[model samples]
Structure formats: structure tokens, C-alpha cells
Target: MMLSSMTLSRKYVILGIAVAGLIGSLTSAGAQIQYQTGQNVAPVYEGWMHNDDGSIDMVFGYLNRNWEEVLSVPIGPENNVQPGGPDRGQPTIFVPRRFTQPPGERREQCVFRVRVPAGWGPKQEIAWTLTAHGRTDKAVGTLDPLDEIDTHVIAENRAFTITEGNKPPSIQSLKADPDTVTLPGTVTLTARVTDDGLPKPPAPQPGSGNAGGRGNAAAASSAVAALAFMGDASLDCR
Candidate 1:
């Protein structure tokens, strides 16, 4: 039976709509990595920092799917750097559990942040990847002179810079309840961290132009550091 022209046109239109929808869905899925329990997303380079030591430090971050899932990936296969490490010793990433987002928010939280030595000539590339339970996602960054990262603009002390006399936060104590627990049971973890870098508000030094109004102003960042928390995280105790 020969179909009418109108019926054939309708059929073609319906098929076109279905194809378009499928394409859109695929594109969206590819745009952002989806991670879940036993699965992980890719790592992204936020930017680089210039250490006091002349070497550039590559800052990387990643996402974890489950809210209660913690993760700890080392600097090796699955998540590694080319040409090997300078032995700066990348820490086992400590990713906090995921959390709920409020309305109108659309940024993925970086549960993990780490820095590695980067200065292997122009071709040096760092690849941060996550693969678990048969799923994999990876992100690569290069230190090439002509690479996408504007290393020139990322001058010394541009964003995050550490200099002499800088001290990191200290852990007073860390405790975990029911360290050894049966299956289907839960454990509680707690940490006590403190930083003494903050200085006590000092009295104005009586400067003519109020230059000393801001105590330790010289140590303060020239520009406010902007940080954003995106979505949630995964579950793999670091």
C-alpha cells in the first residue's frame, strides 16, 4: 500500500525528532562526567601555583559521586604524571563526603586538591584520571610553552603562592569511632585542625596615609581568592 505524502512526511518528522533527542542526550552526557558509587569522574586542573622553589606546581581536583563515599587515589597509574614525580610526594587525596546543593547552583565541588612538581620541559603533561568498577574518565594537562594554560600570565604569587615563613594548618588530633566495625555498621571520623597563620588584629601604627591600618597587609593577597564549591563527592576513605 502506498502511503500518502502527508503520512510519509509525518513519519520522517517523528524520526527526526527522535534522532535529535538522542543526540542531545548523548552530548549532555559527554559534556559532564557522571560518577556513582564504585565509579569516578575525571580530574580537572584548576590552575598552577609557583612554589618558592622555582618549580611550577600543578593543582588538580576531581569529583566523587556518593555523598558518604571518600576517595584516596595515589600518584601512579589510574592517576599519574609523565616523566615521574620529583618525590614531592603527592598525598593520598582526602575527599570529604558529598553534600546536597541549594537552588540555582551548578558547580561541582572539588573534594580533592593536590599539587605536584611540574617542569619537565615544554612537553610535560599531567594526566589525572579515575577508573573504578569498569568505568573510566580522565583529564590531561600539559606544561608546554604554547599549551592552553597561560603560564606567563600565571606569574609568581599570582594566585596561590607560598613563601618563606608560611606554615600550614596542624592537626591537634584525629579520631574515628568503631575503627573496626561489622558489615552494615557505620563509623564516625573526626579531625581537629588548627592554623596559627592568622595574626591578631594589631593597633594602627599611626600612619599618615593609614598605610598600617590593615595589620600584616603586606602578607595579604592583593586580590580576594575566589573559590567555588560545585556538587558533591564519592566514597573511598583516603
Candidate 2:
């Protein structure tokens, strides 16, 4: 009986050590540099209607690994639709602005907001998705993971499709009238930039549909505005 009790004691000691080690490993894993989605703008279709009589207000949100709210910011607003229309109700919140995790910090949640136009169709919402990019130092995760969380918002019957990936701004149009440059006088240069505007695009595969998708429309317009400025400058030089 004495020998059996001694063996039992020894076994319990070994078990305790194993359990403690396992717990330590789990703790370390939990701390292993996880990331939360940062808030950002969702893509908008060209010529699509928006709130505030075609204008939009975008807000963003951020979270930590334990699924806790971290930070939020307003990324700015865009007047995607024309100004004259019946009040499309109050502006909807789309793509709540948020912050990315700083190095060495864990993230919990990322939220986004967009103002939806009243009476917008379901298809319009279907094509829309909230695409967010992790900071350069962080890796992108799968859509399945993101869908599990309440990360996106659609107001007034507007829906959205969420995706993830990396993206850089693309120059949609660039022109220098009189393509050649001469040494003597200044030549106006026109540049148009189109970007998904995300640090990255979701599912960045080859021939992806609308590399920038609906977001490209807004970017294209901005590029055009920039090009117009260049045109003015070029004529001024002449």
C-alpha cells in the first residue's frame, strides 16, 4: 500500500507539470501578434445614390484580439451623388473609421460605416463590400474569419460584401498635352489617380473584378479633377 501511494503521488506531480506547461503555451500563443480589422470606407458603385442628397459620411472603428473596441475615426466624407434631390432621409453611417494595431499591440474589433441612399436596390448593396487592409507589418486573414464578426454596417436597406487583400493607388489617367517636353518653358502635367484606397484589396488575384470595384468610381472622379487642374496649368504655360 505504501508503494502504491508513492507511485500515485509521483503521477500527480507529473500531471501537474504537464498542465502548467500547456497553459503557458496557450498564453504565449494568445500573445503571438494577432491583429484586428481597422475601420475604412466600403466601395461605392459609380453613379450610385448616396445619403445627404448624394453625399456620404464615412466612419471607421478598430478592435483588439479579445474582441474589444479599441479606437474609431472619421476618414472624411464624399459627395458621390449630386446635391439636388428630396432629402434621402438622414445620412446613414457606413464604414466606421478605425485604427490599425500598433506594433506589439493586439487588436480586438474593426468597424466601418457608410450613409446609404434611401430606396437603393438590394443589388447595389450586394455589390458593395467593406474591404480593409492590415498594416504592412500584418498579414491578411480569410473572409470566413471576418464574416463571423459584426464588422460591417448597411443603413436603409443597403447591404455590403466584405473582402480583404492589399492594394496600392493606380494612376487612372496621365496626360501632358504636346507629349514632348522642351527645355525652355514649363509644361503642365496632368495625372489621375485611381485606387481602392485601402492599404490592400481583399483577394488580390489576377484579373480580379474591378480591381478597385465600386470604390474606383470615386477615385476616378478625383483623378479627373486632378487632371483638370493639370490642364489649366498646361494652358497657363502656353
TM-score of every model?
A: 0.40, 0.24
For each candidate, what is the lDDT?
Answer: 0.49, 0.36
* Superposed model 2: Cα runs more than 4 Å off: 34-116, 121-238
Candidate 1 C-alpha lDDT tens digits along 50-157:
566766666555545544345566555654544454222333443434233223322243333344454545555666655544566765655644433333343222
Q: Cα lDDT of model 1 overall?
A: 0.49
At residue 163, what lDDT does model 2 achieve? 40
Q: Score candidate 2 by TM-score against the native.
A: 0.24
- Give the per-residue lDDT digits (tens) of candidate 2, residues 106-208: 3222222345445543333222222233321111122222222222332211222344552434754367766787766666566555667543335433444
| Alpha-carbon shift of residue 183 in model 1 (angstroms) | 22
> Where's the lowest-lDDT run of ten residues in candidate 2?
222-231
